[model samples]
Target: MTDHYDAIVVGTGFAGAFFLLRYLQHAPPKARVLVLERGRNDCKVWQLRNRRTSSLNTEEFFINNNPEKEWLMSLGFGGSSNTWWGGVARMMPGDFQLQSRYGVGTDWPLRYEDLETYYGDAEVIMAVSGPADSPMPRSRPFPLRPHRFSDTDALLKKTFPDGWFHPATTRASAPTGTRGICCGAGICELCPHDANFSISNGLRRLHDDPRVTLRLQATVEQVETSGDLARGVSYTSDGQLRRATADLVVLAASALFNPHILLRSGITHELLGKRLHEQMPVDVCLNLRGVKGYNGSTIISGNGYLFYEGEHRRQHAACLIETWNSPFNYRRAALRAERGRWTERAFFRFMFDDLPRADNKVTVNAANPHLPEVTFNGYSDYAQRGVDRIPAMVDTLAKALPIEEIESIEVARSTSHIQGTVVMGNDPATSVVDRYLMHHRIRNLLVLGSSAYPTASPAYPTLTLSALSLWAADHLFTRSA
Candidate 1:
């Protein structure tokens, strides 16, 4: 490997993959890019055969004792992409200006309009299947049609046409050359059909490019900065210290490690590692009276925005509702469900948005620099209030559909969406990176992924952060060239 490179991109998940893909396309052909990955490049077959995303364990890189808290992620060449369920949704226009519109959290430096084109771009790259109609505005339609919705989702959509609709997802609705059609089996993490989008399945070409040199099992330690610019990065590989210099450095390591690397590099903004969080998820089961569910094409068949936005967000957090089609545990309850009427229930996931809290954060492990100390203080009253509104929300659902009893409502351990920590805003005093995700102190350093999120929107972060990466690369290199 060369001692110098034009650009060094870290992590190969949605953020890094999208950034590097655009960088290679927009940059001159001779431009040399170095890709650093903390995990090894394990292909889809290996992951499936082994029944695991990586050879490495989560605790090996992160240490925490926050009671009842967990962060779900895969740390390999594909990063968390290997573990996601492939449900993609765009942030509402109001999500960008939570403070301005609802008088609650802080506003993002960029708005939904700024990212509309790039959202479309990311959708096109993944060939996302979505509906012609969307709750949020879209400049262009999705590349593929929407996935089939369950009977419950059909009723919900028919009742509330404005919000409830099929979720835009990476799980293939139809057969593609690289992916098989989703069998509606709901095993997205290690999809037996190879349906959902993963780095190995979709964006492997980004690393395989002749101009790009990919180094796996290389853990980045710190960004080498000089004056107000990021020079490169220092990392370890095979128990040997290594250094690579580049004109540009992209930190795509994720919410946990991005802030840790920044702290290790001495870029200690007061809020650098603060507000380490993800959406608070609550799972609900509805014992239906007449509705029969479980007829969708993927795991999460529908999304509901009826309770997602509006003036209520001023007092409490916004909510995003997800309707699940595949109840993996249906067989376990078969005896109680009556063999012929087994599909007469609906499952849901209610995700609540949260504001940044300084108490919840990521810190450098005192014992091991390779590991991160994750501390979570817990969700705020706003999120709790949103959770408290669940019964009322269920009442709204009952108004639309047949009367049913709520079988269970339990808070999920984790959504695996690790966001915040390294927040992005126009203000340098309060934020680590700017609107373009460039470090406030270092010009050439760009921190990619959900780590830049100022506030946790009820919507999914993968598509938004992926769009931001595309927008950042486009803004930096002038894609028109």
Candidate 2:
């Protein structure tokens, strides 16, 4: 027996959730939808009690050949939403015009203006709090009040005034019927107070819709296509092979698995599973002179965009700075045990955007045919230029804050951000999807998420990717009902 649906959606993370949120608005009353999630639903209570997002980890589905390069994700009904920290930032206009502006990387088929309206829509749905003034241009003020900055942030603000603004975040700062006020606890993946946005807390209702049927613990093997049209997908469920067909197909899985599924289905492309990359991150800790921190209303208080946009991107990757203000900020608190040191230290995380490289990519695992083999060669020379400038960047930043000493500067092995396995562009030869995230060849197939990102921006990808999903769904099914 075979199952059929109006649409078959794979994964339930930021991309799939937002897509459904909008798709349901236009889908007809009797429309049948099938949702496939590799992991079972873990309620918010179960996640908080376990002190983690999901009991089912990423290791079960894919094989990470390069363990030194970390790629973190959760497998459950909500996917990465269970583990994401809920930081939200829009991509700069320049991010979309990278190649034309900086003579590096490929330009996205769409523009910031194209997705600007959807960005606000996604923000409203998530109930984001942010300052009026922001680095990226906005049409109107955020839905909620901005999170207040810490005492240390005030001093840093005076030092680096430009582009230093309160971060827009899904971690609640104001009262909402769905979520609680943020208490600045850094364990956001499993917020003890249920403060951060998770699918269980925010969009779980989508799966409960009578028009939709959600199947859990079903691992998709490949998409089954007829000619240039995608028919549906094949998967394993209850230790048996299963088949499903739909009028429309949405491949909303993570970057790794999205390309992996396409490859398994005999969908061939020169750049299908190539260009696997993410932002390079470095953690910097500084002991301030007589100032106290950990006083912000949210986990991350502010974002510094001084080095985010400029001519410098012509030579080096743009860098974004995230100020850590949560109570769970420091890793080695024992080192700061000297009298009054607890309140005197500040931590800042810096991330540099990296261009996708063909050498680093995903391929079908020979050992286990169902798993995807990940290979990350390394960050490009453009990104390396930013790494070499970190010491000087810190020295320049030291002049802003009254730094007593530089405690530690370490490169983080993993940013927990994976992207670029399938990118969007105007030309089918160079990219996988088109401007609306529809497959260039397979018109009925839509692939959503950070997988469509052409380049990694130092700013987080959730808000932008969620907006993309909304835009894609609207572009396709606005009149379906």
Candidate 3:
């Protein structure tokens, strides 16, 4: 007994969701699509039981790294989007042209304009909200209106005047109708109120579609390929090996897993696991004596952008000053910095975008389990530069508001949005996928997600990734038709 489909998409994250939805909507009527998800399908149960479980606990990130530390990631229907805080934002035009604007990285083969329409469509599907005019050039109006600011956010806006410019409120992928307000379940774990939108919702819609079939708890072990064409994928499910064949194969398992899968399949292209990009998040916590309502509210409210100027001659870096106050977490983070420090009152988490450097990369560990290994380089210089810019940006905010003292600051690895491995380009020698997201070596294979991003931008990568997936689907459909 063998399973066959017209298309098979791997991974059920944002990229996978977009690909599944677009193919069902636009693929030839007779084309059958099968989505292969390595995780389970229970979003609520996974969120409730394993919400606190660290993503690094599994073989994905923990194999060669330290065993004690727990990384955060959800392996379920929605993928990481299930636990995501749902900060939907578009990349600035400058992000798309980083190579031309600055000599750091390669420019995207496709311009921002080329994907503008798809971005609009993705916004509708995700139900994102933002002001009519955003800062990005050639921007279009959002499908849904902007989300209103909370009471705490309004106070922060009034208190922080300089350097802090409150652009339109960032959008989330949550449900739009009745259940819009966030219950503030510390979205880092899970959205208990169902206010957040993950790919699980999209999967539910396609459950009955005869053209689509979803296989769960099926870990793809090998991609059987003849030369450059992938014939099918072999996997282990229910303690048994199974294989599925498809005319077209899409790798949407994100930057980390996508490269790992390719490496395991023995496709060692020069750029398979190189050029990793991560948006480094830095936290700046302050103790404001008179501020209330900090603990019980949404963590992030508004952000500010500062273009790097003068002698550095580097591309501009953007920083987000998010309003957050969790007494326990803040105190714990503070104590970790300098033992026996009690942090009370308001706090600000400043997330900064570091320019993507080519040195940072992902590789498979040959000796131990062949799991994913990430080596992040070039952060020392960026950290030193952050020390200078962070306080300056804070000082600009202190002028408008009253602050008892700037308590403590810390930087943490951002698991929310990671991009750039298997980047898209016009030339196959320099990139894994071509302009249409088709692998130059394998005509029937496609690579989707922020992995196709040439540079990591300050904004959240989900909306942009969704739009790119739609664009790729369109190209696939046109070529197949």
Candidate 4:
């Protein structure tokens, strides 16, 4: 790493990579940039094929306090984007005004329009595909057309006319540039065709730029701050403790580690590690009579926003229901004979928006202080309202389509969309960062990624988070220039 640089970015996730690329593009020609990644960038192809490798290891630096609720994250150069399912839904307009519109959760410091251009820019760069008629008022249409859905998704769309639509995703439908199109590998987390969007893909180009220095296997221990200014970052590489100075430092390490780094740096706030939450995945299986599910796509197909907002939200939390078009999850070894009749078994997935709670937080474990501990209260009555209404939704679908049987309805898993540890707002007393994403106490320090979210929308947040990062980069560089 350089002795001193114009900017330093920690972590190489969706946010970090976007910020780094933007910063380098906008920064003065002579300006230097350094990126510190905790994990190495080696054998990415091998990791994609094997499923389990050094790149996808469970982070030992953090542990979940609730055994039932796990917070999974990537430790490699690209971070979670390396293994993301590639869903890129934007937050609904109501998502920005949670407090004003619904009288629940905190409102974002900026509105949807403020980030609309950045969303468009990021989407175009990432090659996202979706319908322009999406519920959200976007400034422009997606870069590519929406993916062709499986027969099951088409049925869901016809049955639930008003609520359903093809999802905007990062998966490539047709060959674009050197990136191959999706072959419906069904294993998107490990895309075999290199079609799925990953920050690592961008980092490969940034690595070749002379202005940017990519430092892998370097763990940033703390951000050094002096009298409201961020000095730089201290990280360890090759068993040596090293400190690098920079004019600005951005933390995109993620929701869990970003707060841990701040707390370790002695930057204390009453809500530093508080208000952590994620969209808990709710699972339900159905036995369809004539329709077969699970073809075409692997993970996501389409989604329903009918329950996203209503008078129902006044009493219970809202949820976004999506169709799982991948057959890999529901396949049984003994059921090999039912390959073509795939729609016979189906899984309807629900992502309930988890409210931010002061009690649910990420903190250093008392037993092992070096390892982070996440404490989350599963769900509240708000979430229960969504769960209670699922059966009725199933009944509606059953009546419309060939009826068979409702096999099960239960809490399945989580999307690992860790959010709100270092939330942003206009007021520092109630938040961690300002509207520009700069730290309240440390002016030159900015925290990126989902960690800056005030609340977790019931949809995937990758596109939204990438937009936020680009917004931050524009603000940061425009002022400096």
User: Model 3, 1-481: lDDT tens per residue?
Assistant: 3587788888888888888888888876777777888777775655567654223234554342433222346665667876676676667666677667766556889888888888878877766656554556544676555444444455555664333333332224234663355545444445566666666653467646877788887777767789878897888789998888989888888887788888888877887877776666666767554444343434444444433222232623555555553444523543223333343345666655565566667787767544677666544355346545777776765665556677677665453576787888888788888987888888888888888777666677888888888888888768745
TM-score list, all predictions:
0.97, 0.96, 0.85, 0.94
- 321 Cα displacement, candidate 4 (Å): 1.5
Q: Rank the candidates by lDDT, best first.
A: 1, 2, 4, 3
Per-residue alpha-carbon lDDT of candidate 1 for residues 292-392, written as tens digits (9 for 90 to 100): 88888788899999998798999998899998778684323311266666778888899999887889999988888777899998988889899999999
Q: How many residue pairs clash in model 4?
A: 4
Which runs of model 1 end up more than 4 angstroms from their true locations?
329-336, 479-481
Q: Candidate 3: where is the Cα deviation over 4 Å?
A: 49-71, 137-140, 143-180, 185-188, 289-297, 306-316, 325-346, 357-359, 368-370, 377-384, 479-481
lDDT value for candidate 4? 0.79
Model 2 residue pairs with clashes = none
Q: Which candidate is the best by lDDT?
A: 1
Candidate 1 has an lDDT of 0.88
Q: For residues 1-481, could you state the per-residue lDDT of candidate 4 as single tens digits? A: 3499888999888889888777877888888889899888745577866674355467567887778777767778778777777888888877888889888877999998899898899888899878656877877888888887666678767777777788888888766674678776576666777788876664568866888888998999889989889999999999999999999999999999999989888888999999898886777777777776666453677777877866666666777877777656633321224556545766778888877888988887778666678888766566767788888877776645565777777786567788889999999899999988899888889999888888878888888888888888889757764
Global fold similarity of model 4 (TM-score) = 0.94
* Cα lDDT of model 2 by residue, 78-184, tens digit: 88888888889888899999999999988889889998999999999999999888888799789889999987677667877776888889888887788999888
Model 1 clashing-pair count: 0
